[model samples]
Target: MADELKRRLVHSSGAGLVALYLLADYFELGLTWPRFQVLMVVLAVGTIGLEFLRLQVGLDWQIYDKLTRDYEQDQFAGYGYYMVSMTVAVLLFDPQIALPAMLMLAIGDPISGAVSDDSLKFVKGPKVLVTMFVVSAIIAAPFLFEYPLAVLAAALGATIADGIKVRIGDYIVDDNLTIPIYASLLAWVVIEFVPV
Candidate 1:
């Protein structure tokens, strides 16, 4: 239960990035795209540094080791993946593509995990996909009002990406990295050509 709570807390915090960006826009907080991009890059750098330390020290700074199985292994962790994905979205894509991309993974993945499959392995459940698409589309509605096709594509792409976890040699590519990138690419493509 604690693990679940912690997972959701971290997930929600990531989703809150969307709110942060939106609030910054509404209040004219001077968070230009370049500034936000630089902030994300700095964050990624810090996270990578901490990951290196975590690899060397092993549990010295692992406060959540007891919470989730994700932290149990002696390897690079998902928090870094999550941070990198979010950073890449903001840095590489426009706000139209980036914000929903972040939210799709941030909000959609946890919902998929809670009801779909909790196993480390990838499992594509039809109900899970549906749930993810619906939730993501709803979450993205406000931002993607002008592009229905792009909205659906983003939701579908993220959900599908979440269903597949890949392993390259010794490393595990968690959905945390894939979903945002895939969704952003899919949505950006759709928006670019769909006469929106």
Candidate 2:
């Protein structure tokens, strides 16, 4: 339980990326869109490299033992997916859509994890799914107030991403990879086509 809480705490810390971007933009620190994209890309690349080192070269770090789940022992971990998803969101979507999407992953996922039953390793129960959707919607509301449809779409995307586990052969599609991507894509589609 302690390890799970620690993992969730670490997961929630992903929001720092959004906070940093906001602060830099608000204060005119020159973190323009391109620079922000570069930052996310760099983080994704670094995380991927670290995963390679950990999985390929057998780097048995202590933190890995504490934070990683049994399933992650033989595959890419969630942190790598988290960074990649955030990078993808920032690169592919407008900030109005992407930042809230990232927050949905960072904040909503952890909140769902807190309420989820650990015994069910794959799909969470209905209550957890509801929690995920509500939290995601609330996270997106501030950023997408003008487009209620977009907000609901993003929340639904994030909830679906977190609530279910999709498998391809031996690999499960981690929610950390899908959450921001799903949210951003859905939000973008609604914002683009649906009349405000």
Candidate 3:
């Protein structure tokens, strides 16, 4: 139980990364869209490089111990998939869609994870989805979501993506990756087609 608490604390602290989305809008990080996209790509590549180093040269730096608990044996960790997915989402979608999606990944996902019990069916429960959707919608509220249905769609997609894991061959899709991509795609599609 104590270990689980520690994991949740580490996971929830990832919400602080929501500041990455606000960097340009609030903090004036001077990160233009192209630069931000490039940065994300670089981040993904660098994280993958670090994972390689961890395997080959015994890379040891770690910000969160709980995050790396399975790293020693697992060839890939959630953070790597997260970086790659975020970069791809930025590259593929407009900022309006990408930012909210990334926000959901960074903030709402942690809320769901920290609240959901491991024994819950499908790694999720009503409580988890409720918290995830509410938090994701709130975070996206001040953004470019002109339609309520867009917000709802993104929130729903994020919550569901966070709750489920998909596997293709030996590669399992991490929630960190799935949440942003799925939410962004859903919001974009909904705003484009749904007359809301």
Local distance difference test values of all predictions, in order: 0.80, 0.92, 0.75
| lDDT by residue for model 1 (1-196), tens | 7778687678767877778778998999997878888888898889878878777776365575743355535666677888899899898889988898888888888887778756665567788778888888887677787899988888877977887667799666778888889888888889888786
Alpha-carbon runs more than 4 Å astray in model 2? 121-123
Question: Model 3 reaches what TM-score against the true structure?
Answer: 0.83
Predicted structure 1: clash tally: 0
The candidate with the higher TM-score, 1 or 3, is 1
Query: Better model by lDDT, 1 or 3?
Result: 1
lDDT of 2 by residue, 36-136 (tens): 99999999999999999999999999999888988899899988999999999999999989999999988999999888776555778999999999999
Name model 3 segments beyond 4 Å from true: 1-29, 62-66, 169-171
lDDT of 3: 0.75
TM-scores for candidates 1 onward, in order:
0.90, 0.96, 0.83
Query: Which segments of model 1 are wrong by more than 4 Å?
Result: 67-72, 169-171
Best by lDDT: 2
